[model samples]
Target: MIVSRSPVGEIATALAANGLILRGGFNFCDDEAAPAAGSAAPAKSVLLVGQAGAAPWPHFQRWLERQSARIVNPLDTWSCEVIGAVAQEFGARAVSPSDRPYLPFQQWAMRAEGVKPSPLGILMHPQYGLWHAYRGALLFEEEVSLPEAHAANHLCDTCVERPCLKSCPVDAYSGQGFAHEACLDHVRGPRGAPCRSGGCLDRSACPYGAEYRYPADVQAFHMAAFAAL
Candidate 1:
């Protein structure tokens, strides 16, 4: 069955209904080492879908309330289902950051948004800072029109304090790299109540996108999931 191609605005509007934004997109070159979209041929383009700050939280909460059984990785499941449905509507293939044989989502984000890593390792956007997240992406057989991704002002370069590095209890993020084990231990221990109930102190220390920061309930949910790891 031939599916009619939806306009970019139509796709973006549909995703926005669920609090998802079109992060950006790029047309794949024939020689590019792009990941296949569950098809024999590589996708002609990709449109990233994500949320800025707590936009997806309410939608996620409502969906969670409707679940009859306990869900493992509820957010990821919701992302897959929502994006998958949209992809089907547009005759595109849906892919997630958590898919097995992981796609280069981080790389794609950089290419699509020109965002860079902060001292805390989260991709710091000029406006959204660490408060944004990529949920999934749609792979299209036809090249979709996209806006140019100009490099945004790097907020970290001018921030003299770099509070994110200093705020961590265990100094989980350092010049070397993230001390994952140290972070995990602290988040799971008795003294980890603050982070467990709120969010990562280091992430909270970021001054760039304070206004877009996730709500306490949303942060708490993510922290609980992190602590379970």
Candidate 2:
């Protein structure tokens, strides 16, 4: 449990054996001014993983649930669940966009201590594009030192065509910012058929990570989650 060195490679191998791909790991400090306080003293570790399809998630969840290790948030739960539970343990409450609509959760998440959104989320990775969703986080009981945060690498910076910005028929993304209401309306209304069937047009159109694209069902599920919010 006291991993003084990089346990990422070992963890990745284990995940691969279980049919899950290790995405990355992050460290969180307890004393940092997190939205929710009272987390364990020192720092904790979170390991991220992705499955090829939806079936693997359920299997992964079952495997995680059976592990003796203390998981702050189990595989089946969302990030909100981990944040809320940790907040409660520390006698604080987690604040998210869903919980506080006016606050910018994306910006807040980026700035928060011990929180690191994967750079892949912003860039089109060789595998998963924007079609991927952060399923959940795994928390450890022990504190671990981490490296300094880095600026997110956005593929949009290098793309000449900027296909992702223009791919959407609804023009949901303006490059300056997203048109949230327009995106939601389009997904929930008649215009949603293509996106609902294939995937987010903009995300799919990204020339990066064509091979790692999320399955259609996974894409639709994530899109539905966004629409529900």
Candidate 3:
């Protein structure tokens, strides 16, 4: 027996080849979505591509090893290559989180997935916890049929301890907000060796979805990038 293929399934296959997942999507015609770039004729839908946990780390590492020269923002560059190919194949536009004039990715994610922010400001996933990220998106000129997004219970709401709020040595996160400078300074200082080698203490402290937490190496890479910024 053979199963018929669908546009969504085909796209998901392409992304999965590179260890990316279609987080979710929404049609611009849905009214709640902000109009696409072109006013006269805008893209009708968006499919977000991202990773859960360290699923993409091995794939990204292999791609990184093949680069002839040092590449800046290597992960982002690779995401564009992979997602751009799929976009071209589907006649869609590819956009990145790093794009200037910053697309409202967070807003779009909430609309598409019904996810809420964790204490660290990263959107919390019911299953993935703090262990996921939005790599890029595919914007189609015509509407695509997509299943409706269901709201998941917010993980933080039920937790009583709230370890993420108390783990940071500098108290970088609080009711006020993240202290960017403080967090940065600590990650770059002598005492920050643990965090630099592992990951953000506050982030790792989150007890929810411990199994989905990123590996130390993956976390270290991101920490280094953050410290450099």
lDDT of 2: 0.52
Off by over 4 Å in 3: 1-6, 30-40
Q: What is candidate 2's CA lDDT for residue 63?
A: 62
Model 2 earns a TM-score of 0.58
- Residue runs of model 2 more than 4 Å from their true location after superposition: 1-10, 26-31, 34-44, 51-123, 143-154
In the predicted model 2, the residue pairs found to clash are 38-90, 43-143, 127-212
**On residues 40-121, what C-alpha lDDT tens digit does candidate 2 reach at each position?**
4433554444454453555545666677876543344443554444434433333433443344334433432223332224
Clashes of 3: 0
Give the Cα lDDT of each candidate.
0.88, 0.52, 0.86
Candidate 3: give the clashing pairs: none
Clashing pairs in 1: none
lDDT of 3 at 215: 86
Could you arrange the candidates by lDDT from highest to lowest?
A: 1, 3, 2
Those runs of model 1 whose alpha carbons end farther than 4 Å from true positions after fitting are 1-6
